[model samples]
Target: MPTLSQQLLAKEAKYGASNYKPLDVMLCRGEGVWVWDLDGKRYLDCLSAYSAVNQGHCHPRILAALTEQASRLTLTSRAFHNDQLGLFYEELCTLTRSTRALPMNSGAEAVETALKVARKWAYQVKGVPADQAEIIVCDGNFHGRTLSVVSFSTDEPSRHGFGPFTSGFRIIPYGDADALEAAITRNTAAFLVEPIQGEAGVIIPPAGYLARARALCTEHDVLLILDEIQTGLGRTGALLAEEHEGIEADLTLIGKALSGGFYPVSAVLSHDAAMGVLKPGEHGSTFGGNPLACAVSRMALKVLVEEGMIENSARMGRRLQDGLAAIQTGVVREVRGRGLMIAIELDPAAGGARRFCEHLRDQGILCKETHTNTLRVTPPLVIDTDTVDWALDRFSRVLSAA
Candidate 1:
């Protein structure tokens, strides 16, 4: 007889859309840094649901807050006030050091909100002519897959057949400050970018690139929108990746880990001047900032900060990166990342990264590949010294064997 996982896999293939090409492991449960398959095999969780579960899966505190608030109240929309919303706003703003916030339900929605804010600010505040505003983006950025976001994308897969696309976006090479300056025009509204291109094989830009970009944005009066959905909330060892260069963005986007992987909660954290463009009825979401989301996100931030997950990320990230680099193997082309957002790039001659990932799965570890040749290792922030060392041993074994 076919196993339960096989049965479920067949069922999904028959019924579900083929949007994602996930690994052939059907997971049943997760806690802390580990997950179990339907066949009762266990493995470390290295992806963290693209950093949404940075606080780890099924955290007790976040779970408690979720259930308690779920029992009391769930949604009231923007028309009514909830008891948890104000507190959530205060805490998040204080932690992120943002003056204002526009709550949403996903990283994509937050990106959309920032785009709208930037365009509105351009016309209303910067004296740009109507419908002439343009936003500059990096070449290999993966902000989100929404139609408007994909319009600026240079990746063919994300853009093919998704258009006739949105307009008013200009493409510039990633990490090129000179290109950014040359691309800016009188109607340029904002410069949207990722500090480290997470989806493009964990690609980090040249040092001082972000600081230069920040200064240019200020000098040109262009709002800097830093999308931290994949890199923020301790994924890169910093509270926000912008802190790495000691720079601030006019609009900051964060999501994924905001609700500890328990709920779909995201927000646009904004500078006071840029956010002032939005009025009472200009924009909104039905489930954004609802009581349940607020409650879960509040606890998520608390445990992440109070429990020292950020510090752990910094220390553990260094240890893991060093260990991966120490592994002597002809297959490894490079090992690079900030914090726990690691990537092991394989030599093209050594086949693709997918086989290494499959080998990892069999060895009781779980990680995924990006851009064909790079495997990303982004375990939950709650991972410890022992776990990092343990994962390193298996990773070394797999790469060395190849």
Candidate 2:
């Protein structure tokens, strides 16, 4: 007979969709920056559910907020107001320094919502011809997996068999400010891009790239939409990755960690002119601003700040990155990132990142590979110096051996 883990794996292969190629470990519980498998073996979760658990797994305060508000009120839809909606709106806007916010359940919904908002803002505010507004996007962007989102995707695997593509989107080279300048037109309503290309192997742009992009967008009278779904809420050590360049996005889409992994919550933070274009009947989500989501998100944002997680991310990030840089350099091609979001591009002679990830998993460090040769290491923002040191040791050993 197969072992329990093997049996469970077989069951999943039989019943589940083959969409996700997750590692073989079967997680049963999580807390702080750690998780336990079915056999009670613990592993430090370096993935953090694609940076969705930045506050750490199952935080007590967020859990309390979730359960309490869940008992009181979960969904009121948009037909009537729930008590938590206004408070959620105020606190989110204040933290993000945005004029208005439109809530949605997931990052994709927010991306879709922002796209709609930009098109409408173009037609109404920018006076672009109806249905003719074009949005410029980067080549390697990973905003979401929606039909329209995949329309402009450069990843062939994601776009395979998923089109009849959406029009009105122009793809430009990432980190090339000149490309952005050349792509702009009066019909270009917005420049939708990620501050740092997270899913493209933690690919950060050249120095001053984003600042120049921001200036170009402003000069061209275009809205700058920063998809911060993977980079916001202290994942990049700052409150938002755009802070690294000292620029503000006209519309910032955030999700993932908005609820500390307790619930799905996302929003589009927009300027007054952009968000003002959305009238009542124009757009809505049934569970977008529900009371439970609002309450949990409020506390999630609270603990992330009050607990000094953002500060910790910056400090630990420097230590971790420096340590990784000091590792055995033969097998490593490059080590680059900001804050807790990091990646290691392995040299081709060392085989592939998948084997290194499997090796690290055996050492009780649960990391994931973003590409065939790139290992993405993003731990929870709540990670401490000691934990960073521990993770660095495992990474050094695994990559050195490779």
lDDT of each: 0.95, 0.93
The C-alpha RMSD in Å for every predicted model, in order, reads 0.7, 1.0
Residue lDDT tens for model 1, 286-314: 99999999999999999999999999999
Per-model TM-score on C-alpha atoms: 0.99, 0.98
Clashing residue pairs in candidate 2 (N, C-alpha, C atoms within 3 angstroms): none
lDDT of 2 at 83: 95
Q: Report the number of clashing residue pairs per model.
A: 0, 0
Error of 1 at 8 (Å): 0.5
Which sections of candidate 2 miss by over 4 Å? none
Q: Cα RMSD (Å) between model 1 and the true structure?
A: 0.7
